[model samples]
Target: MDWHTLGSTPFLPPLYWRAALKRKITGSTLPEQGLRCRVRINPNDVAAYRKVCGFADSPILPATYPHILAFGLQMQLLTAKDFPFPLLGLVHLSNRIRIHRPLGGVSELTIGVQACNLQPHSKGATFDLLTTAEDSLGLLWEAESRMLCRGVKLEGEALDNPLPTPTQVSELTRWKAPADIGRRYARVSGDYNPIHLSALTAKLFGFPQAIAHGLWNKAHTLAALGEHLPAANIELHVEFNKPVRLPSEVTLYCSAPGSSGELLLKGTGDLQHMVGKWQPIA
Candidate 1:
């Protein structure tokens, strides 16, 4: 596969429009080309991300922070001319991140991203945007983000991996998701999906009001479990079940750190927003 080294991070807004206007390709295979960039981590940006995601101050990068570094490249891959799906209407179904070690005092990272694993879902087609972060030493972090394209059916049998069903559980803690969180996260993560921006834009896409980003909840969960996280070799998998509307109260249910367990985030009326788990990679 060919690797295209980006000189700088591609701006997201224009790519969305460009992908919307491009003619959709009709095939299963993604482009063989991939994207890579060398980024010097900005201390200010990292601090901003931690504050938004409720993480405590730390010299090491948060487990989910690499995704923010590679998001623009993922957007570029998804919006390429040969990509089979449109960029605007796709849904983030799930995310799986693996951290090999905590990165601190690392001035730069070589980030890479590519699209793969095209599969048929009952609702539509789904695919994975695989991303990696590395430095001169070796790979530090990697992730698989599954995305769904509604109304686009493929020929293969749809895979069935249902999200965990909501059950009554005691809340570990509650968090207030402010109305501007979507915009705040967007500023840090470069994901400006309209559904999460404002009630006005969200209503156009069938939501009553702006919703929080799925990964934001994932980040928050990790932040809450910060004490339990190991210094290296861990896996975090999260599935998006329902959208948490802006200006809403949400709760988290999870087993204490240093053990195996489920992590659930629910909004009002026991509406499940996310279900997930984390384990050490021994």
Candidate 2:
């Protein structure tokens, strides 16, 4: 994973400029290299990280931090002599994850990541990458993340594009999310973002209530996938279409494969509100 060589492409063109404009509006970008890493999900670590993230108690690990292990491994990969790229300039444009299981205590986990296609943009270049994580028993807990990167521009105002209408994929699951889900997630993962806590905070952000953190949904989704899919060496891709409201009855709609195979998980609501997609990492 020579990030430097990977990102050394020169010359910006009109198409890239157009793509950059579109990304500015959509908040999308590509990351450098994606690779796997390992982490020990210790209960103590979860409790410590939770307090640091500002939760009153240890919430469940936010669904997203497992990918952080991927990122941590990525950093190590970048340090290899064969590795390329400067770490300072990269920025996280967007992130999406689907959890297949709930992380209860400390366990050894493996993460998989890969750099994807790069599209040019006015700011610089937009690169995409994928990441996945699994446990020792060969159970996949979660998968999928997309990231973007670009060079700084002089004008500072990158071009923006109109919002594309979201396509309705499928209805979300009908499982009832626990009332303490948000607090639990906040505690486990050290993310104290008020939007996942107080009603007033969510109201300020235009949410109906203090919605469940995205990572919580990811964790639960991973737990579910692990039940049916072959845990070892699995890959997945997911998109966040809509927010899951607190204490809501959500039904998970998943497309999974047989043991030693591939699968897709697309979720929707009873009212047919499309949530997102979960497929093997390409």
Candidate 3:
């Protein structure tokens, strides 16, 4: 890969606009390059993230928070002219995160992002956006986010969906997801995808109404299970099954944290939005 290290994160809004233009240009293929940058955690930003995602106050950064640091790099890569897909329509299918140690005392982290694992999906093609974060000490966190570029077909067998259906779950908690949740999260996370911003913008992308950001729901679920999370060496995996429309009431359900670790978020009419679990890495 053509790797380039940057002194600061790239701005996302322009890149997003670039993506819109690139979508109209045909024959673009995934690039063979990656981006790396150094980032310092902001305590105030972490606090705001905690309040939005429902995490309890802690000096330690929540496991899901690091994705925010990696997002700009992700956008830069996806919006490049050589990237194969448009950022606006690609669906976030699954996210897998691994935390190797506590980040409470860490001040700066080196973050890297690359796209890989291009394969076929029944609906279209799928690929992985891999991100890593390391401190002066060593690698501390990483994640693999799978995205589906719908309606694209390729010359390979499609992989079966690996997310298992939930069974025998007990209600854990309910949340009223406000219509403005997308705007709130976008202000903090920098993922201003139109589908998640407002109903007017969402309809342009075929979504009947504004949809909540999948990572927001993922973070909220992790926060609910915060008491059971291990100090370090843990992995959290989640698959988005459906979108949670705006101004909706959703319920979190799981068999039990210690027993099964399986958790899911469902909206009105019992629409399953996400299924996930967290486990201590041995």
Candidate 4:
């Protein structure tokens, strides 16, 4: 918890771009943590984000959009020269988001992002980056993004997969996501990671071609599951396993509505793409 301050830094050369350029330019030692940043939401950007994420225009802000608002703050921590671990080759294991209230009424927010809780897995080392957004009303939203770092396995107990295996899943919806979906999401979310935008750029980082943003997968999945979500207080969590290749078709799946208020989405070859649970705040 070094608690580095991010004062008025521009959010250009996003996380992916910086990582691709600095994969081999890191220090032999570890980096510090607790980096923070803030921003005022622009009305125009919010509108564009809503369009890209399929959130209808309303006075109220979509629950997931706050993650997009925190993107710049996230990039700040990810690209910090002192930050440990190159952004390249880092796998997004899972994402958990909690919104205490709808933010459509709020116009400004203060974002704080911190990287903490580094633990080792059988396959690799894993960590969680926690980001919180606070407004005049107090902390309105918070999210925990989990990442896996391969080649950094440590001696410890094997990590148990919290997700249930999908057995009898039925397709809920299928659609072809265009090659440009990544770029579109990048523009709206300010996550212009090269791997998600271009094949040539992606090849630099070992991907055969460009891939969709994991957050985009979560957003679209949420849009599909909108009818089932509760109003106001909600928490959504998804673990990403495989990359959804560019210009590929996607089919969402589910088992049955359990008492847990969960909805599942699986990938081909039975790869676990995402498992989301939505519950109302009591």
- Sorted by lDDT (best first), the order is 3, 1, 4, 2
* Residue range 104-134, candidate 3, lDDT tens digits: 8877899999999888789888889999999
Backbone collision count in every prediction?
0, 42, 0, 2
Summing lDDT over every window of 10 consecutive residues in candidate 2, give the lowest-scoring window: 2-11
Per-residue C-alpha lDDT of model 1 across residues 134-156, encoded as one tens digit per residue: 98889988899999887776788
lDDT of 2: 0.47
Q: List the candidate numbers ranked by TM-score, top first.
A: 3, 1, 4, 2
lDDT of each: 0.85, 0.47, 0.86, 0.73
Off by over 4 Å in 4: 2-9, 14-18, 24-32, 153-155, 166-171, 254-260, 267-272, 280-282
Q: Which residue runs does candidate 3 get wrong by more than 4 Å?
A: 25-29
- Between prediction 3 and prediction 4, the one with superior TM-score is 3
Q: Which of the numbered candidates is closest to the native, going by highest lDDT?
A: 3
**What is the TM-score of each predicted model, taking all chains together?**
0.93, 0.47, 0.95, 0.86
